[model samples]
Target: MTDGTTQPKPPRPPRRKRVVLADSRAPVTVLRTVLELEEQTSWAEEVVRGFIRTQFWTAVKLALLVIGTLGALPLVFFLAPGLSGVTVVGVPLPWILLGIVPFPLLFGLAYWYNVLAERHERDFVDMVEK
Candidate 1:
């Protein structure tokens, strides 16, 4: 057995590598699944309709609240004409309420609505996922 040629060695296989991600536990979305749901069930449509209704009612309610609060101010001034002449720090009360106060109040309402709408969307997503 000494003088002959040797057999060739087998080739080595490639090494497997692991991948790291920034967020491992995030929920995954599939377009195919969503499309299937849309085509196959009314549930998605109902959920969207419900979401729209919730948003619409929320907007309506906030609108009414703003209108009522600001509208009543004018009515109060008209009913009590002496109030218009009253001043605080040399600024008319009506001007303070109508001009200065409303901007902040409206901004607050808009912020609240944004938060509410986001919460609604989150809830809808949760429901859909379930």
Candidate 2:
């Protein structure tokens, strides 16, 4: 079992160095517009006020439309009294107009308002982010 010649060990592979992608000590800067908004500067305040004014005017217009349309129904019925007695599927015309019509009208108005409000908000955000 004893061998006179001794065998040498295989050579080892070379080690590789690690590489760094980013430096943590680098300086970071904030945008001027963002800083102004956060600090409530005069410029930022004016911009925000303008956005609110636009939204307020939009709401007022929608409110007027709703009021005018619904308010005119009663006046129309009063002017043409014969129309009030008319029936649809045995239900009074006035009842159907007053009860059923307003729901769809209001729903449509609400959806329109939502779309307008979201558009305004999106515009505001884009302005601010820029």
Candidate 3:
């Protein structure tokens, strides 16, 4: 026995609106705003890049400062006079290497390096900005 069934109808066609392409000749107002935003973004990016360079140079200088300090240790002791009890226990003042002098010297050097590094970068960026 065969059963006869009615077939379902097809879906309706889709509706569409007219398409528009971007016009090359934009209005003066829109173009002006775009230019303003672009300038703002350019300035911001320049600031960010300048900051990056400054920070990098600072790191490099700091590393060099540290290395220089460490390297000078031997020279400092070598140049010190033989023990004369000017320091306690007959230990020469120069013997006070890591315990005293080097620490402060390293710190001072670090501060100096950082300041100079920051200044140089600031000047460069300022120049570019102008």
Candidate 4:
């Protein structure tokens, strides 16, 4: 118990050597569907055509909705001539309705379109992957 000498430590185990099975410089093969898509095969073109059609219809619907909402404003003002006299914070009711209101409405519609578009793309990708 009174010895001043310290005991030597045990040897550690050897480290594992990394073994690579594949050559890093070799060209990797792409998936069949991915290759088809890139090469624009008939099947791939059809799938892409369907996606474009869906997007076109979506844009058309949104455009119609915007047209309907904005288009109705002028008709409403014309029908109710008394509305022209109305004002909010020194700005005419028509001015606020036409200028301020459309921004938020358009923004909301854009957000909706973006969500639907992303969903459609996601679905398309899933279908392709399968």
lDDT of 2 by residue, 10-127 (tens): 8888788788644444323326676788899999899999999999999999999999999999999999999999999999999999999999999999999999999999999887
* Candidate 4 error regions (>4 Å): 1-30
lDDT of 3 by residue, 1-130 (tens): 5479777899888988878553457666555545544586765566667777877877887888777877776675667545323575666665676567777887887788778877877776455434
Judged by lDDT, which candidate is best? 4
**Ranking of all predicted structures according to lDDT, beginning with the best and ending with the worst:** 4, 2, 1, 3
Report model 1's TM-score to 2 decimal places.
0.70
List ranges where model 1 is wrong by over 4 Å: 1-37
lDDT of 4 by residue, 48-113 (tens): 999999999999999999999999999999999999999999999999999999999999999999
Model 1: residue 130 alpha-carbon error in angstroms: 1.1
The worst-scoring run of ten residues by lDDT in candidate 3 lies at: 80-89
For each candidate, the alpha-carbon lDDT, in order, equals: 0.83, 0.89, 0.68, 0.90
Model 1, residue 98: what's the lDDT? 89
Clash count for each candidate, listed in order shown: 0, 0, 0, 0
The Cα error of candidate 1 at residue 34, in Å, is 3.0
Residue 80 in model 1: lDDT: 96
Query: lDDT tens digits, residues 1-130, model 1?
Result: 6668888888889888887643445445544336646685576677678888999999999999999988999999999999999999999999998899999999999999999999988987776664
Q: Tell me the TM-score of model 3.
A: 0.42
Better of 2 and 4 by lDDT: 4
